[model samples]
Target chain A: MSENTRLRPGDTIGILGGGQLGRMLAQSAASLGLKAHVFCPDPNSPAFDVCAAFTVAPYEDLDALDRFAESVSVVTYEFENVPGATAAHLDAKLPVRPGVRALEVSQDRLFEKRFLSGAGVAIADFAEIDSQAGLDAALASFGGQGVLKTRRFGYDGKGQIMIRKPEDAANAFQAIGAVPAVLEALVPFDCEVSVIVGRDLDGSSASYDIARNHHENHILKTSTVPADVSDATTRSASAMAEKIVAGLDYVGVMGVEMFLLRDGDEEKLLVNEIAPRVHNSGHWTQDACLTSQFDQHIRAVAGWPLGATERHSDAVMENLIGADVDGWQSVLKEPQARLHLYGKAETREGRKMGHVNRISTRTA
Target chain B: MSENTRLRPGDTIGILGGGQLGRMLAQSAASLGLKAHVFCPDPNSPAFDVCAAFTVAPYEDLDALDRFAESVSVVTYEFENVPGATAAHLDAKLPVRPGVRALEVSQDRLFEKRFLSGAGVAIADFAEIDSQAGLDAALASFGGQGVLKTRRFGYDGKGQIMIRKPEDAANAFQAIGAVPAVLEALVPFDCEVSVIVGRDLDGSSASYDIARNHHENHILKTSTVPADVSDATTRSASAMAEKIVAGLDYVGVMGVEMFLLRDGDEEKLLVNEIAPRVHNSGHWTQDACLTSQFDQHIRAVAGWPLGATERHSDAVMENLIGADVDGWQSVLKEPQARLHLYGKAETREGRKMGHVNRISTRTA
Candidate 1:
């Protein structure tokens, strides 16, 4: 799709990998007079609850993919781990956004790191490790302080292990089931921050305010906006995001996770990871900004002009993890809190149940 | 529900009436992480495409009502025309928001006028006409310039007739099937405006920016925000809205249609009617305000604190009547325009197909 030929209201948008992100994306699309048709394997996926149409078939099914492509004008995915063949299958029939380049970079950790570094962006020190010998040599060169992570299908602190000593490498490899991996020097940082940025097909890019994120048991717990970062640092972060988007020729929202490193007199930044789709940290935008990340993503993918990224108020977004949702009534009673609950059938420990976004003119 | 017992994310909300309004409400509820179970007689209602669950049965089906009430935490309706017994049926089992009082007042034109007048809100000159003689007397008082509208089941110019001359009263009454009706003196207003106001259980109310409406063939064509009215007139319009809400002890968003009449040097406002649910004129809020009417309705009925009522920018909302939806793709190309499409299966003339909300910093 060209930037001039944007999808309008009543146009069908096909979303891949139906989940909460897809659910929110569909809702945003609906609010703007667009229809979303979710295509995913799970028949009970939460995204289907809000979308106008859905296809219950695995991503690998060519017939299902064809039917999904034919049903909507444009297509985008919620998750990056979709098999390369699956994306290729959908792309052949329709416009698949965030493009193949973003998917390729995000699917493999080593490739993602190389891409970031090649774009002249700051990232953690890393070394590729394909076998036991390669891991041993990388560990010896690094003074035995690094993390070994699988190259694919890893998220939320999974498929990785810390290595403090030489003997720990074997168990770490075994922990990841001896999958193809990379070893990188762990950066000791003060806090984690993520920038959710969107790039339209017309090359117009916009970024939301960076967020100071806190996580518990590898799951996001809270995100405070206005990120406690200096105005100069925030500008630099936004510039870095723009560089990444321009480099990838990216379309739609992408999350760039960074570490705020305090080195003596100055605060430095190091890229940690990149998410090809909307990030959990940017959830605050729904309540705090004029246009939300979900809406931005849909607009970018549909080849439409981007909305203003200006925020309306200071915000604090808190995730409702498992029993955290039990006190939903109390949270709702908080006069300025905007609560969002995913209609998940079963809520298990560490699962993302829902979230509350409290907006206040009162700022810290 | 009490103020402290406001609903949070992951709660279930029951919606009565499975039409476009219900579909939009269900989409908003889902965005807030709440599940919606829709109850309507038509199995093929468009809203069923998005809701978590739905029951297809007559409004008076006690068994279905019981099951619906048992499944949802709160019950709200999309239209005011819900049978009085049906609202009572759900109200007896669960909390029905906007309450039966608001529904009763809006369901009948005569009751709406009485309620507005009793609340000290300005209303058009009107009289209840249960017989032909009553209509003749009302017409005589109006000097034969009046409108005869059915007390019940009237919307979008249906069940209404204009009496231009004394001799036309009989045919005008016959046009409405001679049902119980109300005859009102037709005010030569400069413009039509509406205030979409929300009232929480705590008696707190919030009103959206007033919209100046234009109608063609008795069908709403467009609603422009930042209505060209004096500040005093705007204040009175909003105050009248608050009074109406307080009178009904309402707990959801309601649309108050008003006439902008210029009498000598002063502009006066008159309450035309009350829509006890989200109105098409309020569709612009989805893109132009901090909180949308559907979201505000969900928030209010769920006993949550209302969101900010701030309008983002000056906006114009245009309804895509009939085959105008065929040009949806072209409309999407406008950067400032936000399109919203109802998931109706077919497009019929005079039907509310969808709407586009165009927000710009510059006023038209």
Candidate 2:
């Protein structure tokens, strides 16, 4: 897309997913006086409740995609797993930010690792494993301890198993349905952190403060801003993220998950993964900063200038998973807590229902 | 309505009037996981671009009103002039927050003044004027200096005439089309200010910081939070707002516009008018407070607990009238400014296109 592709007010942004992220992207689009048209197969998608328009059809349906594209000026997705064909189809029709290349690379683990390595960013050592013998050989090279992950469609610790010893590898390939996979030498880190960065259509970039993340059952539980990492580590992580976005010629906000490893008296950072859309860890920006990650993403994709990434207050964002949302009443009563509920009808276990961002005055 | 009228996440809120206020209210409802259905006669209503559902029919259309009411759990209005009959029509089918009484009282200046006086809120001296003789007689009593205004449908300096001298009354009656009016003694005010207060279904109330206002061409130009008033005056203003809401048994956010008059070593506040819905002055809350006026209004109308009213930053909110919105690009580049545009298809002179909230750290 050309640098002159700025969207005017009242223009509709076509979003390719209809989940909470899509719901939030729609809200952010509305704040800027822009409209949102969500496209998702789920008729009951949470985002359908807040968007100006929606197309409920499978991503593979080209006719439906054409109709959706015809109604919008630009397209963006809320999930990185948008089918390559879907992205390619829309890319041919209109501008799709972060582009198809980001999708193609992040969709597979092996490709993601190679991309990070090629961009000169530090990452865990990994090897593509298409067979049981391949996994064993990679494990032997990594000293018998590594994480086996599917090359595609894996999220929240799904489609993977840990091989700590010879016995632990039994039926490991079968456990993940024998899908094409990658085995990576696990890096022992002090804590996991992530950086949310936004790249505008003009190649300018901005990043938010690093957030220290904690997980439960492999799902993100909480993200606290002003991460416990040293200033050098924060700079290193931000530089890595900028490099990756620049390397991909990416536009819009990207969340780069990283591991902060302690090396004696120094700190080392490793790129864990890259999310080419707004991530859960950046939700704190909604209440603590002038421009939220969602808003920044919309701005970038619309060819507008990126908003300030400076957060006025420190915050801790906690996701409301499944039954945990039952405590919404109490969350509402908390003085510093801002509750954001995704309009989901059902509360199945492990489902992400909503989130709360607790903010406080910034501390030096 | 009962105190148990709390709306669930997926419940829809029926909003009367699809202007900018309704648009922001719809966005706030979405944030809380509630759906918004906007009802308005204008098919191009700005709120339509943000709401889940919409009805393009006159407010007086009972058939459309009935159908619109049927699809929502609760109803609320964005404008005070929601025709008592239309409010009564919806109130009969479901709970209409702020209630019909607020609409009845606020729709007519005569009723509003009388209600304020009856509620023991300090207000300017005024007398109803139904005829030329009455206008002349009332003008004589106010030291030949008062504002002659239509008792209904007057806003932003419209439908008002100043009678400063004997000659000023020549075509004054004919100027306003000789409608039923109110003649009020003009008081020398130090400045204009407003307070936004929210009262829940259970009768509990909370108020945001007072905002000092400035007007240009009779339209609100700016509202600066932490109004330049004594501590006692702020307390007095908030107390007056709470008293008025309690008197009306109001549920939802109410904006009480007041004139701050300076006396010997004292600050006196008089109720100028009451907006039974969220007010433009409260737009500052969107960027500075945890719970914005729109969010508080939705929470109250939905019968949910009110969020905190404390502002994390000091803010100055300025309305973008007509061509002022053309400066949105510059506003977007400002690090501390948050731009909000009403999705208006056309920009006409005197139209309220949007607003910008500029914030800074609070200082004691």
Candidate 3:
């Protein structure tokens, strides 16, 4: 698809994976007059409740994948764990966005680090570990203080462990089931931030303001806009996001997480990771910006013009994880609060149930 | 069902009649974590696309009605023309909102006018005509100029005819099938306006600011916020809406259409008609206010806390009728335009396909 030839209101945009991200993505697409077809193996996926059409099929089923590609104008996935073969199967027939290369790099920790470092983006020191010997050597190089994370399928602090000392290296490595992993020195950063950027079909890009994030038990708990960073630090974050998008020739929304480290009187940015889909840290954009990150992702994949990212208000977004969702009544009654709940049947420990975004004129 | 009891996220809302209105209502329900079940005889209903469950059965099917009432916690209708028997059947089993009395009144022109007049609300002069003699006498009393309309099922100028002279009364009567009808004088009003109000199950009420409306070919063309009415006129409109709600014991969002007339030194409000559900003139609230009419209706029916009805921006809403939807590209490209299109398979002349809301900082 090109800039002039774009998907219209009735066009169907197929989404891969089914979670809160897919559900929110489908809703945004519907608001813009487009239909959504969700393909997932889980029958109880929350996205099935909102999409116009859905097919309950696994990614490995080539016949189902072919049928899905034929049914939609373009395909995009909410989760990054989709096997490269599944994406390649659909990309041969139609457009699969964020592109195959972007997906492959983001799916692995080592490749993501290399891609960023090669693009002249500053990143924490890292080394790959394929064996027990490699893990021990990498830990020693980082002075026994680093994180050991599985190369694939790691999210919300899962499939990862922290190494605080040399004695903890072996246990942390075994905890990840001896899988391929990467070890990076834990930076003494002051705060965590993220940039959500979109690249259209023609490679034109736009970015939302940096979001300051807080984590509890390694899971994102909240994201506040007008992050406590200098204007120069924000500029550097946005520039780095654009560089990554161009490096991968990405088309769709991608999230870049960074650590804001204090270097004496100056602040420095360190690339932590990249999410090749809408990120949770940017949920505040739904209430604050002219167009949300979900809308931007849909626009990019549909080959439409990128929407303005100008935020109308300052915002704070809080995640309702597991038991926290029981307090939904209060969020529902709060003024200027927009509440969203994923239609999950059961809430398990550490599972994300929903989120609430509160907007105000006050920036702090 | 009561003040202390409230519907939760997993609860299902059953909607009667499948149209664009039902589609929007279902979406709003889903946004607030509720499931929607749409029941319509037509298989191609646009609302079926977004709802969790759908039953394709006519209202006359007793078995289908029984199953539907059992499947849902609460019942609401998109159109007021729901068969009396169908509503009675559902109300006997579950809570049916805006109840049977409200439906009966709004479905009949004479009944609505009588109820409004009895509640001390100002309205246009009208007289019920049971026969040809009565029609002629009513037209003559109104200076030989009046509108003859069927007491039931009249909308968008349908099932009605204008009488400019006594000679035209017979033709007008025949045009409406010579049924039990009402004659209303064509009040020389300057402009049109409407108020969208909500009544909770507890009898607590709230109203959005009046919306100024414009119609083309008797179909609603546009609605803008901050209506051109004085403070006294606005207060009078709000009071009239509350009066109608209390008179019917309504428990959902309702639309009260009125005429703004210049009566020499004073501005007068003449109640034109009341819609038992969300009104097209209130579409501006979708972008301009904290809570939309759809949200208000769902909240009221579910017995949840009514959302704040504060205006956050100035807005103008325009409907896309049939071929006018071809300019969707321009609307999509424009900044601050939130476009919504019903997933209709085909568009016919005079059919409402979708709408666009444009917001600005300027109040005028």
Candidate 4:
């Protein structure tokens, strides 16, 4: 890819995925006087409603990709699973920030771990399990409970199996369909947290406040600012995110999920995974901060200077999954809640429909 | 209109007018999971881009109006200029919150003054100017310079003219096309300010902090919250807003513009005008307060309880004119400027293209 970067307001931002993340990114871009051109396979994608233009086509359709490139100044994805060939197609034309290297590492669990380890970042104990025997050996090494996950395309608890004991190793491997996977020892952490970091084309970077997150059935439920972790832990988590961005020369909002582990007398953060796009946990920034993560992503990809990630108030963002959004009116009555509903036609079970952020002044 | 207000999340909101207010309102409604269907005469309206459904027919089109009413659960307007017949049509078919009373009282300057006076609200010295002679007579009665304003369809500085001197009255009258207008005595004031108040269907009301405003060429240039007015002035202004809401039985966000005039040893506020729907001056609430005017609007029309109107911090919202949005990158870098762009297809001279809100914690 060429090292040339050019973007500006009024320019169109081409997004690869059309989910809630894409919807918010488009909303943010519109707020900046920039137009978003969403490209996704789902015709019912929520992002289409907020964007100025869109094309619903398979990611591998080179003709559609070309048209999308012609319509936008820069390209970014809302999800990491954007096919490599698709990114390559757009990169060959206009600039694709958070480049292909970042995608390569984030798309696969094994590659992400290797890259983090190489950067001297702390992560969970793990080993690549490409075969059944390899899985067994890895499971034996971890002793007790370990999770065997497919190396690629796994998200929100998909493509993983838990090995509760040595006796269950074979069944666990079989449960994962015997695919190439990575074995990670179960992490005993105090809490799950994430830090959203942004990088510009010029290598500048900034991180938002650490968010303590809770998940139900592997999907994010609520994210609260000023995670119950110590200030030093936040610093370490942000440092890890910055190091990852610098290592990958990444641009745009990248979410680094970490586990706050208590190691005897001290507490440390362990890098669990890296998401190369805006994460759901950062949604509170839309109401609590000066610039939202979506706008930050658009700015970074467009080669604009990174915005300040300082938050103005304490906030909690909760996702309205499936039928939870049905009570939108009651939530709106909360006086302090700022509601966001994605314009999706169908609210099937387990689907993320919208979110609400309740903001309040931080107590000293 | 039946009091059968059971609007849920998946409900459709029919919005009248397709200007930037409608566009932003639609965006906010969608964020809360509600779909917006915009009805306007202009086919290329900016609001069309972000809405799930749109009708490009004149407000007088009964067939279109019937279809629009059948499609959405509730109806509201973005501008105060909703034709009497248009509001009547929607009111007969479905619930139109901030109903015909608001439209009837606000669409014309004469009616607004009469209504406010009847409601026991204080206003400036004014009289109807049906002819050029009427303008001269009002000037003679008021003593010095006054204002000549068209009674209907006037906004910003469009249909209003300042009579700086006795000799300028006829010229100012002629400048405004000598329409059926109002002549008012200009009251000397310290500054102009406004309060944005929201009322639910059940009559519960909430008012945002008074915002001190600045106008250039009769157009709102900027608005700052925790207005530089005294505490007493703020209370009076807010009470005035609440009074209008109760009197009109208004549901949704209404902007009440007032003037702070100094008396002997005290400052008093005089109501200048009433906007039946969301007003430009209240745009700062989106970033500086717990509930934004747009989201609050959606709540009101959806039969939801009004959100809190608490100010989160001291804030300044600045409008971006034709070329003002060009420096969005610099604005984004400010760490405090929160940008909001109206997705207009074209930016013409003196057009309100977008706005940015800069928020900071205020020292008590």
- Give the backbone clash total of model 2: 0
Considering every candidate listed, which one attains the maximal DockQ? Answer: 2
For lDDT, the strongest prediction is 2
- Candidate 3's docking class is acceptable
lDDT, candidate 3, residue A51? 88
Q: TM-scores of all models?
A: 0.86, 0.98, 0.94, 0.95
What are the per-residue Cα lDDT tens digits for candidate 1 across B106-153? Answer: 989988898899999988899898788888888888888898999999
As for candidate 4, its clashing pairs are A335-B307, A335-B308, A340-B31, A341-B31, A341-B32, A341-B33
Clashing pairs in 2: none
Q: TM-score of chain B only, all predictions?
A: 0.96, 0.98, 0.97, 0.96
Estimate candidate 1's alpha-carbon lDDT, on a 0 to 1 scale. 0.85
Comparing 1 with 3 on TM-score, the higher-scoring candidate is 3
Predicted model with the maximum TM-score: 2
Off by over 4 Å in 2: A1-4, A263-265, A362-364, B1-4, B362-364
lDDT of 4 by residue, A230-270 (tens): 78888898899999999998888999999888877588889
**What's the alpha carbon RMSD for model 4?**
2.2
List clash counts for every candidate, in order. Answer: 7, 0, 0, 6
**What are the per-residue Cα lDDT tens digits for candidate 1 across A1-364?**
3224467566888899778888999888776667889998999899988887899998889988888888898888999998899888877777788887789999999999999999999998899987887888888888887999999998888888889876788667667888889998978899999899999988989899999899898788899998988887798889999899999999999999899988775888888899999999999998766578998898888777787687757789999988887877677567677678777878788888889987764332
lDDT by residue (tens digit), candidate 2, A174-234: 7888999999898998989999999998899999999999999999999998787788888
